[model samples]
Target: MYPEPMSKSLEGKLVVAISSRALFDFEEENKVFEDSDDRAYMDLQLSRLDVPAKPGVAYPLVKKLLAFNTETDNRVAVVILSRNDPVSGLRVFRSAQEANLQLERGVFTRGRNPYPYLTSLGANLFLSAKEEDVRAALNAGFAAARVYPDSAVAADRHPDEIRIAFDGDAVLFSDEAERIYAARGLEAFQAHEIERAAIPLPPGPFKPLLEALKPLQAQPAGAPMRVRTALVTARSAPAHERAIRTLMAWNIQVDEAMFLGGLEKADFLREFEPDFFFDDQTGYCDTAARVGPTGHVVSGVKNEVGGPRPSDR
Candidate 1:
């Protein structure tokens, strides 16, 4: 009998699964695919096999995350979980190589839903340009977001740090308070949060993603690569207490917290210059994207039809 083959493991590593479109600037090529059929797309990609595609919105984040891995410790793993065919995948891998990314694993589903494989890869987060795949991953209890293809790329100011920002409701914590705000008004919402300030809000979809980042944040000072996180929210003053208390209750610490109380978040995000920012409401995401890379977390009441509009937050 032949001996059993040994399977490689991604255990004890933070695994990120990203779509090819999210990792590289395939907009032009994707336009061709959208206008034509699969054969045309494959032929175009094969023809440009020697060409290295430009970096996409998520490239800076992925590049910094991969820097955590070292010869002695492989702390992070980035895998291409794409919907392109095998033929086009060659260009994707070539792009990553030319960009100096040490990506080694990928799953190309040929225009099919690829989120199902996230569980097999033990993905801590999934970023894609397709909303359907992101929703599927979120429904399956994985942290996922849909990247805006036209969003601005991250600034090169912080070369060695991976800076990320997230909204409070529906992103890091449950949207229970947001529901009350939607049905009632700001006064009622503040009253409700003040009443329950002692109670920690329930975990949100991206809570696990934040928790997973704690270890990376804990890397020793002067480490080659570091992580910084922020909580940027519309809740201010009285309502803010609950959000802070919630993080304390969960034993997670964010480097910065902005309680804008419904102010425009773009200016603040521009100053912070995050590699990526995630918010449940597309309105906030739209503005933030103007400053830096942004993702729409399509969760909570704000995203529902006829629910509270972005202004309500």
Candidate 2:
């Protein structure tokens, strides 16, 4: 009898599922797709098969994450989970090869929602340009965000380091306090947080992704790549105490924390130069996108139909 084949697994690895549009600059082809149909888009991609797509907003972040992997140590896995057809997938794989991205797996749904595959892939994070897909992933209890395609490219200041920034409520922690703030006001929210300062806030959708990064962050000093995380939140003073204490309770350590209160976060993001920043409020995301790559976490009360605006927060 033949020997049993070795089983393949992504155990203990950080798995990221990224859409093609979020991974490459497919805006022109996407326009063709939107204006025409799948056939036209496939035809255009086929003709440009030899051409490599430019890096998108999330390229820098993906590149740095992949750097965690080594010949002997496979620390990360990035799979292309996109809506493009199999034909267009050729171009994506070709472009990744040209860009030196060691991506080897993908799933093409040809315009269908691909969030369901996240479960089988054991994905810790999912980034896509489609809000619907992002919502589905988050609803399914996975970390997901809608990428801002037009956002500025990441800065080259920290080429070897991956810097990620996240908002407090909704993005990292449950939006319980945010709902209180929305229904009552900032004063009520602050009071609630103060009352629960000793208690750790519940985990949000992105908490798992943050936890996955903890091991990567603990790598030895000689590792080729490093990760730096920051919390840039609108909460100030007493409210900040809960946020800090929450991380402490979870045993997660962030490199920096900025309690900006209600001040604009764009300027602060520009100075921090994170590879990507995530927030639940579109208004804050819109402004932050101008500085660097940003993702909109479509969770929490702030994202509801009649939710309060960023200015109100």
Candidate 3:
């Protein structure tokens, strides 16, 4: 017998579920809530309902991404999966309206874990400010990242290009090498890469998301905006060969690749000026955030988290 068809409403679309804090600057109100309580926060947001919040780190990325939906048959869907109570979510919608963002759906968890809903949403990627939520999302098999509020906001570097960067080990690939590095030291890590250069490292949390992006990357040549991915890793020289070979093994292509070894990535990211950058280490995110939007992958040995969990991919 033949199988059932897919849901037309969501068939062949890239769905991204992001949080309010990740999409808009809720730092001030977040401070209020943290210093005080939820009641005070809700009151503040309701009082300032007419006031629009400023764009946060992922704002530009979202705006550019939504631009791809101009076609009658939409190719993308973005949902606001925020932890804010439904009441406070008003401000989020108001801000999205102020920015002329065409967002239409959301789920306000009211301080509860929002990761479970990602499965029902069929989310290809989830972005949030809460590390717990991101971790939960990843554990549940969805691609998730913790947005750094302190990181640089998205810039109008190139209106027609969607530039995204990714870190190597512990991010695009499994933390196996990271495990060796942490157990021993940098010397051991380099040695492992050299020895296993021909062996492709296991896939990491973002591999599913990267695979999903391939078809989107193949969009028409002159589409208003196109995705240009880059591999910005800390591995340099002999270590770089393995990474290149690994991508070749996976049959994936990155527009540009940078192997910075041990150098600080902020300056390099500043030059690349990606709309968004994902790294497993907060250090890179903190520094790179100053240049452009950034997200922290809360996975692998460095994250003090467990190995890849079985999930949706």
Candidate 4:
């Protein structure tokens, strides 16, 4: 067996914090009635706890964090939970402990306060706090939006990390949908989506990025690898052809990919876990951030464009 690494201070890498709900992908049985008190908090973070998750499902998230941590020596999966919710908090911490997850001390909620726990620990917490936090971060030129209310405070914890994730298609790829929308309009875009459902769409804008990281992939972890990447797109099976092709063309490999069809992406994201998940749509990012961290990829389409070509992004 490989010797377990000692838990040392996470000094230089990015931390992708996740909640138990996302870490375990709680089963349907864990579902709580929407009427519960925990389901109606002002910050919206507490309300997400009603969703149930199992610790066993946290393997991937743990493994990725371990790999990232081992390679770059800067990765940590700080499991953040509210001390007010002791049962869930204990469950999350124990699960990580059993897996020997390289966790930066567990967080026990600071209420409306932003204590910057991850910052003090030298790892970033990829989340935001309150709407003001989002607005202020964005206003201050930090990539901010109403990511996930529950984990919004995540940003408050770690502000230095790039903390980015991606959804396939329009986000990382060109605005083909917007292109189709311009050429044939909304009906055409929808038609293209349906037609391309099996044909697979082309790569998104970030394809070049993945290609750039290819060399890094060859460099083993702990040797100073920057950026943690994943694919949290809603496409699956036959529809996933284009995403795979794009990566192949660009020669970029992602750290992870979850094909969830139309199921709540947040459910799977809770497990793969990310600092921020970028998607063209708001709902996916909204739900995903609840479990981990999420972001919206702004479209940079030119208005007079004659539609997106394969080489566009």
Give the lDDT of residue 285 in candidate 2.
94
Model 2 residue 255 distance off true place after TM-score fit, in angstroms: 0.5
Residue 252 local lDDT, model 3: 91
Highest-scoring model, lDDT: 2
> Relative to the unseen true structure, what is the C-alpha lDDT of residue 185 in candidate 4, on a scale of 0 to 100?
53
Which candidate would rank higher by lDDT, 2 or 4? 2
Model 4, residue 32: distance off in Å is 36
Clashing pairs in 2: none
lDDT of 1: 0.92
How many residue pairs clash (N, CA or C atoms closer than 3 angstroms) in each of the candidate models, in the order given? 0, 0, 1, 23
lDDT of 1 by residue, 1-313 (tens): 9999998899778999999999999999889989998889899999999999999999999999999988988989999999999989999999999999999999999999999999899999999999999888988999899999899985476998999999999899988998888888889999999999999999999999988898899999999999999999989998889999999999999999999988998989998899999999888898888888999987888777565574647
What's the lDDT for all of these models? 0.92, 0.93, 0.86, 0.48
Write the residue-wise lDDT of candidate 4 on 1-313 in tens digits. 9999987654443444444444543333133423454433322433444433344222343444455455434434454532224444655555556656655456656233223443454333323323443333323322323333244323222222233467776655665655665556545655666666544355554454445334435554544334557787656565466666666665577777776766777777666545556665656656665666555543334312363333121
Q: Write the per-residue lDDT of candidate 2 for residues 1-313, one digit (tens) a residue.
A: 9999998998799999999999999999999999999999999999999999999989999999998988998999999999999999999999999999999999999999999999999999999999999999999999999999999995466987999999989989999999898888888999999999999999998889899999999988877789999999999998999999999999999999999989999999988899999999888999999999999999988777675654446
lDDT of 3: 0.86
Decreasing lDDT order of the candidates:
2, 1, 3, 4
Give the range where candidate 3 is weakest over 10 consecutive residues by summed lDDT. 304-313
> What lDDT tens digits, residue by residue, belong to model 3 across residues 1-313?
8899864465477889999999999999999999999999999999999999998878898998898887475778889998899999999999999999999999998999998988888898999999999989988878789998887664677999889999998889988887777777778878989998999888888888788788769988988889999999988888888889888999899999999877888888888889999998877777787888889998887777564332110
The TM-score measured for candidate 2 stands at 0.97
Each candidate's root-mean-square deviation in Å?
1.4, 1.4, 5.1, 12.2
